[model samples]
Target: MALPPRPTPNLGWSLEEPRNEGNSLSVVERRMLERGKKEHSETTLATTRALQIAEQCQEMASSTLIEVQRQGHALDKVEHGLDAVEQDVKEAGRLIKFMRRWCCFQILCCCDCFDPDASMDKSRQRRVRMRAQEEAAMAEGQREFHLAQQAAVLRMANKGTDSAYNGNDAKARSELFAANIRRKTSSREGEALPGLGYGLPDDDQHELQRETQLQDANIDRIGTTVENLRLMSLDLQGELESQAPQVDRLGDRTHVVHDNLTVLAKSARRV
Candidate 1:
C-alpha cells in the first residue's frame, strides 16, 4: 500500500485516541465557562426572586387600597346616617317645643280667665253692691212711712183745724214752710222727693214731699250701682285682654326653646 501514505503521523494515534485539540478544554476556558454558568444561574434566580417580591408588594398594596376604600365607605355610611338622624332629632325637638309653648299658652290663658286680682275686685264690688241694696231698701221704707203720715195729716187738717183763725193758719203755714224747706233739702241730697207737686193741703203734703225725696234717693243709689258695675266689668275685661297675649308669647318662647334643643341634638348626632 505504498507505505500507506507514510503512516499518517498517527496524529489521532494513541490507543485512546489522542485528545483532540478541539475537544480538549484549557483551564482558563473551563474557569470562564464555569463563571458564565454561575452568572447565568444567579441572573435567573435574581430575576425570579425580584418577580416574586414585586408580585408580593403589588398584592399588599392592592389589599391596603381595598381596606382603605372599605373604611372610607363605612365612614361615609356613618356620616350619612348621622346626618339623617340629626334631622329627625331636630324635627322632633321642634315639635316638642311647639307643644310646650302651646301648653304654656293654655296655662296663661287659663290664668287670665280666672285672674285672682279680678276676683278681688269682684268681691269688693259685691260688698259695695250689697251696701247699695240695703240703703235702697231703707229709703223705700222711709218713703212709705212718710206717705202714710201725709195722708193722716191731710185728713186731720181737714177735720180738726179751726178755720177763721188767721193766726192759726199763719202758724200752720209757717210750720208747713219749714217742712217744705226740709223736704227740699232732702231732695237735693238725692232722697226720693215725695209727690210734693200734687195739690194737697200744704200741712199734709210735707210728708208726701218727704216720701218723694226717699224715692229720689233710691234712684240715685241704683244709678251709682249701675255705673260702678259697668266701669268695673269693663276694666276687668280690658285687663284680661291685655294679659292674654303675654301668655301666648310665653308659650311661643317655650316652643322656640324646644326647637333649638332639637336642632342642637341633631347637630351633635351628626358630628
Candidate 2:
C-alpha cells in the first residue's frame, strides 16, 4: 500500500525523456516543392508544341520540293519535243532545195520528149523565136552597113575618075582650037610657022594620059568594091551559121526550163 502511494506521487512529477530537433523539412519547404513541379509541367508542354510546329514546316518543304521536280520534268519534255520538230522542219527544207536543184539541172541538160515548138507554152516559144530573129536581123544589118561603106568608097573613086576625064577633055578641046587657028593664020599669011610640026596637041596627049589613068582608077575601085562585097557576104554567112546553132540551142534550153519550172511549181503546190 505504501509503494502504491509513492508511485502516485511520481506520476504527478513524471520524469519524461529529452526531445531533440533533427534536420527535417517544414510546411513551407513542402509548398516550394509543389510549385517547382507545376513549372516543370508547363515547360514540357511548351517543348511539345515547338516540336509539332517544326515537323509541320518540314512536311511543307518536302511537298514543295516534289512539285518543283515535277515542273522541271515537264519543261524538259517540252524542250525535247521542240528540238525534234525543228530537226524535222530542217529536213523538209533540205529536201525541197534538193528537188529544186534537180529540176534546174534537168532543165539545163535539156531532158528529152519536150518539143520546143509544140509542147512549150506559146508565149515562151514566141519570145525565143523573136530573140533568134533579132539576132539574124542584127547580123543582116551589120552586113548591109559594110556593103554600104564599100559602095560609098566606090562612088568616091568613080567621082574622082569622072572629074579627071572631064579635065582632060577640056584641055584637048583647047589644044585643037589653038591648032586650027594657027593653021588658018599660016594659010592666010601664005607662010608656015616654024613651030608647027605634025605632032599630037598637048591637050590631046594630056587627055589621053588622063583618060587612061581615070580608067585604071575606075577599074581598081570596082575591083575593091567587089572584093569588099564578097567579104561582107562571107561575114554575113558566117554570122548566120554561128547564130543559127546558138538560137536553136537556146530555144531548146528555154523549153526545157519551162517544163522544169512547171513541174517544180506542181510539186511545191502538192507540198
Candidate 3:
C-alpha cells in the first residue's frame, strides 16, 4: 500500500511508448526525400551543363579575339606597305623633277647655241602653249588618278568600320547572353527546393553557386576584351582614313613629275 501511494505521486513519469525516430522515417517522408534528391541531382546536372556551355562560349570568344588581332596585324602590315609605296613614289618624283629641270636647261642652251637671234615663230609659240596645256591636262589626270586611289582606300576603311560595328553588335549579344545566364542562375539560387533538408548539402549548393559566379566573371572579362578589340579596330580605321589624303597628294605629285619629264624629253629631242 505504501509503494502504490509513492507511484501515484510520480507526476512526471510518461505512460506512452517511446518511438525510434532516429532509426525510422515515414513512407511519405522517405518518398519526399527521394524526390528531393532526384530534383537536386537534376539541378546539379543542369548547372554543370550550363557551366560547360559557358566555358565553350569563353573558348570561342578567345579564339575570335585572336583572329581579330591577327587581322589587325595584317592591316598594320598593309598600312606599312602603303607608307613604303608613298615614300618610293616621292623619291621617284624628286628624281624625275630634277632630271626634267636639268634637261630643260640643256635644251635652252642648245637652242641659244643653234639660233642666237632667231625669235620663236607664231606657230612654234602656239605649239609651245599647246604643249604646256597638254602638260596641265596630264597633271589633272594624275590628280584624278590619285583621288580615285584615295577613294578606294576610303572605301576599304569604311568597310573596316562596318566590320567593327558588326563586332560591337556581336559583343553586345554575347554580353546579353551572359547576363541572361547569370539571371537564370541567380533566380534558381533564390528558389527554395521542396524538401531541401533531404536534398544537396548547403555546402555543395554554395560551392556550385561560387563556380557559376566565377564563370560569369570570366564571361564578363571576355566581353570586355572583345569590346577593346573592337575599339582598336575602329581606331585603326580612322587612322587609315586620316592618312589617305596625304598618300593621294604624294601620288599626284609623283605623276606630275613623271609628266614633266616626258615633256622635257620631247623638248630635248626637238631641240
Among all candidates shown, the one with the greatest TM-score = 3
TM-score of candidate 2 to 2 decimals: 0.30
lDDT of each: 0.46, 0.44, 0.49
TM agreement with the true structure for every prediction = 0.30, 0.30, 0.37
Q: Encode model 1's per-residue lDDT on 66-110: one tens digit a residue.
A: 343334334434444444444445455444544444556665756
Residues 170-263, model 2: lDDT tens digits:
5335434544544454344433333432243454334444444443433443443333333334433544565556556655655655565566
Candidate 3 lDDT by residue in tens digits, 191-216: 54444343444664455455455445
RMSD of each: 63.1, 65.1, 14.7
lDDT of 1: 0.46
When sorted by lDDT, best at the front, the candidate numbers are 3, 1, 2
In candidate 2 the C-alpha lDDT for residue 148 amounts to 49
lDDT score for residue 239 of model 1: 38
Worst 10 residues of 1 by lDDT: 158-167
Off by over 4 Å in 3: 1-24, 102-271
